[model samples]
Target: MNRRDPRVVRRLSSLRRRRLAFVVRETAARVTRILLIALGVLILLAGAVLTPLPGHVGLPLLVLGLMVVLRNSFQARRRFIRWQKRHPKLIFPIRRLMRREPEILLVAWQQLLRSEKVVLRRPGWRVLKRGRKAVRKALGKTPLS
Candidate 1:
């Protein structure tokens, strides 16, 4: 195990090769990250352009782009967190979608109920709150927690 022992030491050439391989791996990783970030940005742009369409085609693309960007870029994650704190209600759905196990149906239902409340505002209809409570209960989460 002595460093001076010929049998225990690697050849200088092999050591150099190892360092070179490490450098290549690191460079490749950096390039891949940059490329992914760019791709994510392009997807986000496309989503924004398609958002006004009637079929709801762009929302998923936006979420996918956001996930990619957030996963690959530390700056994006930090900015997103800052914005989320400033506007929790606006960012709530996006945060939910970003979770490892996203509640897509629940978010959709909640948005639907919210739109109904906004458009109708019937005093007798407590469907939004009740829907939240029911979904939360089913998921073993406390309502409004």
Candidate 2:
């Protein structure tokens, strides 16, 4: 545990060695950050263009773009946090997608079931009511509630 020990001295000497000048390191980091922001913007634009086309393609691209932008840009992160605070409900789905293990299928199924419930509220829609009941049960909810 001595500061002047031979082993400690070698570690400290290695720590002081610089592989690159400070300015080079800073410039490289800035360039990389700019490239990432540009790439994120491009992805976002692509997502917007593809959104109107069909299937479940564009949403993932949009989420991926948002994640890249948020990761690389401090301003974007600040704005996202502010928006998230102001509109938790609107931001919830994107936040879910940004998770390490996003439950895409489950989220889609839940949304589908919710929309079905909203659309088929009449008593005559017995088939969907049964489906709703099954979904509720599978999700650990009581059917009556």
Judging by lDDT against the true structure, name the best candidate: 1
**RMSD list, candidates in order:** 6.4, 7.4
Looking at model 1, which ten-residue stretch has the lowest summed lDDT? 4-13
lDDT of 1 at 82: 97
Q: Give the TM-score of candidate 2.
A: 0.71
lDDT scores in order: 0.88, 0.84
Count of residue pairs whose backbone atoms collide, per candidate: 0, 0
Q: List pairs with backbone clashes in candidate 1.
A: none
Over the full model, what C-alpha lDDT does candidate 2 score relative to the true structure? 0.84
How do the residues 70-130 of candidate 2 rate in per-residue lDDT, one tens digit apiece? 9999999999999999998678778888999998977776667667767888756746567
Report the lDDT of model 1 for residue 71: 92
Candidate 1 stretches with Cα past 4 Å from truth are 1-10, 119-145
